[model samples]
Target: MLLSVEKITKEFPIQKGLFGTPTAYLRAVAGVSFDIEAGEVVGLVGESGCGKSTVGRCVVGLHQATDGRVLWDGKDIAKLSPEERRTLRRRFQMVFQNPFSSLNPRQKIEDVLLEPIAVHGLFRPSERAAAVQELIEQVGLSSKDLQKYPHEFSGGQRQRIGIARALACQPDLMVLDEPVSSLDVSVQASILNLLTKLNRDRKIGYLFISHDLQVVGYISTRVLVMYLGVVVEEGRVDQVLKSPRHPYTQTLLKASLGASVAVKGEQLSPAQVVPGCAFYNRCPHAESRCSNEKQDFQEVDGVWRVACWKWHKIG
Candidate 1:
């Protein structure tokens, strides 16, 4: 596995006052687990605040998980020293959601790309300029654009530049958190295609996080559906999207694709702990046992898995 997240959980402490002891915690991610193999695109799909982005952040080491482990090539990343982690950063990178905010307006695009190469010492001083030129071209930009500021480009073009910046590190896996969510529909397709082509050519695996199912289905080979900080269903893209077993996944598909029989329920908070299934309140097929007993992940077709106790009966 290129990346493996084993039951990782992230919690933010909620303080009572300016200097008071922590009273509670907001559980953003609750024991979410997944893996990405080399050259594989694994989509993590959910609505806002479903903890999908949190999972991506944890994978890239932007956030230290409160519990469990994040393993890189079978070694726990949390155990690495700061200097070791810095050296290892070149192998993994992240692309942020908003292109407008991700880049520096004050710096030229060339300087932006050069910073990583300089920090990582990827190339000799004389070779760095040619490397930057190649990086810009790989993402479909010309050398002239490198002299321009980030504010000069459109949203889509800026996003392409962001991707080039990530590529400068020559990473093995990228954690993309809603990379195209802020772009126009036509622009979104271009960015998605660019990502697909890069993955194919470079064999760089991706953990694509998004709230859009259509985008996820288009880019990912496999999918993990999450709700309220936990995975509800996971399987091959076609298996889970075409014939979803969990109610949350079904609800998302219906809501996104205009299907009927939509599941509905009151909005719930991640901090609100449910004794049983996190989705028990919303599941139409939920039973008394669903609200009483916590459900374990049950394998369906040897590869597919669901956390709902009544998955067999629901779908």
Candidate 2:
């Protein structure tokens, strides 16, 4: 395995009063587990607040997980020393949802792309210029354009630059947090193409997080359906999306409109924890057990894993 996310969880304290000390907590990601093999794409899909982005952050070391393990190359990244984590940072990187905010407006593209290389000490100063040129060229930009600032490029071009900057470290795994969500449909196609080409050429693994089922279906080898920070279903993209077992998974596929579903359900609330199933209130096929006992995410007849008590009965 290239990366193993073992039951990761993250909690944030919520305040109540003006000088609130801490009234409640929000579990953004709750006990999620999965693995990404070398040169594979694993898609995480859910609604806007289903903790998809938080999982990506935990994988890339942006957020310290409140529980569980994030293992990279067989080492638990959370337990590593500061220096060790910094040194191993080059092994994985993240591409944010928006390039405009992620990239600096004051810095030129040359410096932006070169910063990672400089920090990692990947090359000698004398050999740096040619290396920068190669990276820019790989992302389909000319060296001449590197001298300009990020705001100088179009949305798609700026995204390409963002990708190039992530590639500057030559990562084995990338945490892509909705990398194409901000671009035009036509532009999204080109950026997706660039990512596909990079994966083919570099053999890099991707933890792709997106709300679009169609996008995930197109790019992912396996898919995980999340709701209220929990992975409710897991399977090959075709099996899970074509015939979702969990009610939440079924709802998400139906709402995407591109996927075929036999029953439709409503979007969920990302509120405080419920003792039972998170989808109890909105599940189209909910029963008494759904509101009383939280279902376990277990394998079903060696086909796939689901957290629904009625999974076997779902058609």
Candidate 3:
């Protein structure tokens, strides 16, 4: 496996009052597990604060997993020593959701791109300039933009720079957290195309996190639906998108199609921590079983898996 996440959980303690001790735990990612093969793109789809970004961070070693293991090439990343983890950093990289915030405003594009190479000692001082120039061209940025600071560029351009910097380490796996969500529709396509091209040419595996189902459907081979820090559904993109088995997945599709206009009650708050199924309260077809009993993932087909009790009944 290129990457394997086995029962990985991340919990954040909620502090109450001014001198509050931890009162409650917000389970961001609760026992999530999946695997990605080499050169494959796995899309992680969910509403905001569903812990998709947190899971991505855990996989890339940004946040140490609160439970279970994140095995990359048969090694648990959480167990790696500081030096070992630093060495393993070159094997995986991440592109953040916000391009503007990810880059330094004062640093020139070239410096930002070259910093990874310098830190990893990948290139000599004399060769670093040429390497930076090559990276700029690889990401479809012009060498002329090398001297420009991040604020001088448009949002799309800044994202392109982020992509270039992530690629500087020649990473085998990339966790892209809403890479195109911040750009214009027109620019989003261009960035997606660039990512697609990079995957094909470089054979880099991707864990793409996004709430935009349409974008995920366009690029991902497989889709994993997350809710309340748990994966409710996982399947091939077409299978899941066209015929979603979970009620939450169906609701998400409906929301994507702008069906929220017809819904009568108050919209479900995405941030609220749910008890059983994260989507149970919002699901139109939700039953008492949904609210009381936690669902477990079960295979319906060779390629599809869902965690809903009513999945068998739903076509």
Give the alpha-carbon lDDT of every model: 0.91, 0.87, 0.88
Q: Where is model 3 more than 4 Å wrong at Cα?
A: 16-21, 260-275
Residue lDDT tens for model 2, 1-315: 789999999988876666877677788898999999999989999888889999999999899999999998889997899888888889889999997898899999999989999999999999988999999999999999989998898888988998999999989998899999999999999888988898888999999999998899888888988888998998888888888888777767776886665454554555576888888877778888888897797786454789987888875
Model 1 lDDT tens row, 1-315: 889999999998865666777788889999989889999999999999889999999998999999999998777899998888887788889999999999989999999999999999999999999999999999988999999999999999999999999999999999999999999999999999999999999999999999999899999999999888898899999899889999888888888887785567654888788888888888788788888787889998866999987888878
Please give the lDDT score at residue 184 for candidate 3. Answer: 99
Candidate 2's TM-score: 0.94
lDDT ranking, high to low: 1, 3, 2
Pairs with steric clashes in candidate 1: none
Candidate 2 global lDDT: 0.87
Model 1 residue runs over 4 Å out of place are none
True-vs-predicted CA distance for residue 273, candidate 3, Å: 6.4
After TM-score superposition, the amount by which residue 29's alpha carbon in candidate 1 deviates from its true location, in angstroms, is: 0.6
Error of 2 at 76 (Å): 1.7
Models sorted by TM-score, best on top: 1, 2, 3
TM-scores of the candidates are 0.97, 0.94, 0.94
lDDT of 3 by residue, 43-107 (tens): 99997878899999999988988899999888898777888878888979999989989998889
